[model samples]
Target: MSCMQHLVALLALCLSLAAVAASSNHLPGGVNLNERFFNQVRALIKRRMQEKNCARVHCPLSNVHLQPPLVDDEVALQNQRSYDNVPIPAASVPTPVLVENWPTEQHSFGQVTAVSVDPLGNPVIFHRAERYWDVNTFNESNIYYLIEYGPIKEKTIYLLDSKTGAIKSGWGSNMFYMPHGMTIDIHGNYWITDVAMHQAFKFKPFGSKPLLTIGKRFRPGSSVKHLCKPTSIAVATTGEFFIADGYCNSRILKFNAAGKLLRTIPQPPEFLSLQVPHAITLLEHLDLLCIADRENMRVVCPKAGLKSSHGEGEPAATIQEPDLGRVFGVASYGDIVFAVNGPTSMLPVCGFTIDPRSEAIIGHWGDFKNPHSMAVSVNGSALYVTEIGNNHQTNRVWKYVLA
Candidate 1:
């Protein structure tokens, strides 16, 4: 081997190594190849600038053109412009629009708060018969008698037809003080919660009266046999149900369809001790309970059924709620998880769908005055939102059909 031949071979090897390094500089190891071409172009331009000038100085936007070209900035700019011009196809994004305002003749609602769809595809809702919620005063106990309690009194719960949004039939009058959450089981049972009264009731589907009551009316207690400001209930297909006894208790209770208490799970350790567990939705298929830790502004998942005692509160892994003033209601309709947040003052009244696995917010709609509780249909095609009203007296329910 001659000296010149050795030098030539070494030079070729160095040139090859340089070429490999240059190729690697633009193409990252773990990049998604199918990502937008412009995105790749932008990444390449950025890497070129970083590699060519490690000593680049920060300058004001006005003086950006004064500096030497560390890299071809125009190429990056042109690529970005091309990407910006690429319009997103309409089919890829969800189109959510208000389908109905639930306008029915003589429809007088006093802060209709909790809304749910029954097995037969009817909207079942619960509200205060005479009283409406006032966020200003926060005296939910007082009725103030909006309408005279005549011979025919107010009905707190209303069953509305899906197509008409007209009041089909009503019940639960003189039963709930501050109606909060409501749900229907596969067996056609109605479960309701009252915050001001701190009680939960199990009523036959559309029954005129409650069959069994969990907590005593006007009584707030946290025990196996008692509940404190119970907020929500999730019923399983087999007549089993779970309640978020979270408003004040910081716990969840499981019970059989026969009104027998099974177990209680206090705040798990993850939420720095579960602050304000405002709402919960049961993902029966996944056997997971999605809970909104409202005060902390995040969502968590607990073991599906219930627990005996408070262990280290480890919220479900990788599930996070959206950033908002408060998250009040959550519902899982098959694979979709829906949550609504706000009181216009604190945060814009809005509703959004969440990714069940990642818990990332996917879509949003804001126009509510003060939405408190929500419900989704069996097919995951419709969303029902009940508001407490802007005046704390706005009695309205908005239905949104997902497209």
Candidate 2:
């Protein structure tokens, strides 16, 4: 994480906002284009989406850079408060069964980035077995990864049976350099993202060939046609989808079933601080747009209107737990919303939940060092989670039988 680079960007935003406050009016025109500027722009959007739209939501705008419990708070570092360690009711508590024998020589996922399931309840997992999720900086380098793999296995995408936890099929070994997020459409098509490759692919039902591809592979830009390290994907039943362009850009890009850019959500100027939208999930029944604003350390549920057209959403609610760390991968089923952490978060509790009705913290668990990605069953009876795996940590995915 480039804290210095993003903090420098926040400094620029502070200066700009100070200028606006001095003027006693709306923001001025014509700011320079740079990392700091972009950082603040995303930060600004994150702020407005949380504050402006609702009276019940009580979260204060937390500047990702200046806040105490933020990135490198020395106080939090020395004696970090273990806020989420309390035990939940035993009946509601989940017991995990780790899936084993991955094809890699290490028998681990390196760093499992995303996981989901099909209509038949088959689990689909994506991981960076050989590469790490990169920061926003434009890198042309050839070294460093989340996990270094040996010469044995290179494939990172897989489909597994839920009954026996057996690998059904595996492909994309030649495609992905940094596997990040995966989702299954209603039609059983696979949607996957590769941050290093800078592209999103949609595959036919259990087929290796891509039926559609989004973003120009290996190209990064701000235009609608380009994507910058998109972190997660949300696909609606009608084939309209949204992408959380987190690392480089902080806006949610929506597209139609035909792959044409339909509309962008939450324009840039609306946020106040740190809008790294690291994960996204849609609650279609309630018209909710849940986003894991990673650096801001909270989840923003915008009242997105799901009609065929694309546009901004009303600020419905913002949920933040002090011990949440950095919210990354998220999944929604029925009334339950599940979220996990990024690489850099308070490790004691890697995953947690939220009650959509009352907007309250339920608790956190998943006895692992890091909950890299997560998925929920359609009926909300099961939860699948993964963690960062290395020489020290076990490479495994857990099936939490939810009650």
Candidate 3:
């Protein structure tokens, strides 16, 4: 059939589907498939048109204008706009020195998204293989168009020796689309999130099959049973966990041991709404949950056990220092919270050590190009960071030891 015929048929199918949904009142999962469904259909149609135009010109639109052009002065103004009056931290924590010649072998990766140290001190890495998230990656519904791009067949998970950066073992082939956050629980269970899949999975250590999975596969919704682009997972000893429902839904979700939804944790009133709870870490000792609120460019901490009605509560503390600079990931070692931020127009990419109690920036570190997620060692002696790199050119797993 011609393109015009296909478009007409699609529109007719959409109308029929809408009518059926309206008559049923809601979808099978109790999702109100109303205007949102129509919006998704429209977005799909628009994307098809854009792709056709690009094909006609023999140029891919996805390669054009990935980032907005900014002049030096504009970048400087944006970097100084938010925290001009805030005082920079004076006292420095123990400097973290990069371990040279680490990861002993040269291995190529595609957008390493997350890294965590296992109980045996091996750094487990979650990467995207060859898949890349771009403007056309997801539709308005936040569901990845996987039919156009097949699932990655390569193993996306890797375990490396902490001392030598040598591969200990690797698994997770034919699994995961866009690997995001990952964590190893006390019981040796691996918890991971996939933004493209819109779900979180719990796997037995070194096992390929998921022991438990959260969210409907490839379906994005605000309902309790569904998650839109989940970014991070933080699990407790008791098996209770929290997930950062990222990108589209900017909120934190809590679940019980058996993968049952508990409730959505409320963001602080100060943030009328969270832009992106991109990464989250639990401070078990301090009984606090800290999140890297990415677009807000701050770290928000609230009492881990605090409960409120209808997702409303105040944070125990927050860190919004100028040096914080677009936090992408947050990790905690004891009471001190560590955060990594990508570069702005003016500032270079760096990380910060914050005293959560005082909400002060205590220490600073640099030398990262595009740090996505980070993890501190069990003994607090070393730090593991995964960088997505620019255009997936420098996908690397970095290790730093306290000096």
* Most TM-score-accurate candidate: 3
Using lDDT as the yardstick, the better of models 2 and 3 is 3
Order by TM-score, highest first: 3, 2, 1
lDDT of 2 by residue, 30-106 (tens): 44334454354466445433434331453222222223334466764665322222223323434333334433333
Q: What is the C-alpha RMSD of each candidate to the true structure, in Å?
A: 18.5, 13.3, 17.4
Per-candidate TM-scores read 0.67, 0.68, 0.73
- Kindly report which residue pairs in candidate 1 clash with one another: 268-313, 269-312, 269-313, 269-314, 270-313
Q: TM-score of predicted model 3?
A: 0.73
Off by over 4 Å in 3: 1-93, 267-272, 306-313, 390-393
> Which ten residues in a row are the worst by lDDT in model 2?
59-68
Q: Which clashing pairs does model 2 show? A: 9-36, 43-272, 43-273, 43-274, 44-271, 44-272, 45-271, 132-146
The TM-score between candidate 2 and the true structure equals 0.68
Model 1's alpha-carbon lDDT is 0.63
Q: Return whichever of 2 and 3 wins on TM-score.
A: 3
Q: Which stretches of candidate 2 lie over 4 Å from their true place?
A: 1-106, 133-153, 268-274, 308-311, 342-347
Q: Model 3 clash pairs? A: 103-165
Per-residue lDDT, model 1, residue 237, is 78
Q: lDDT for model 3, on a 0 to 1 scale?
A: 0.75
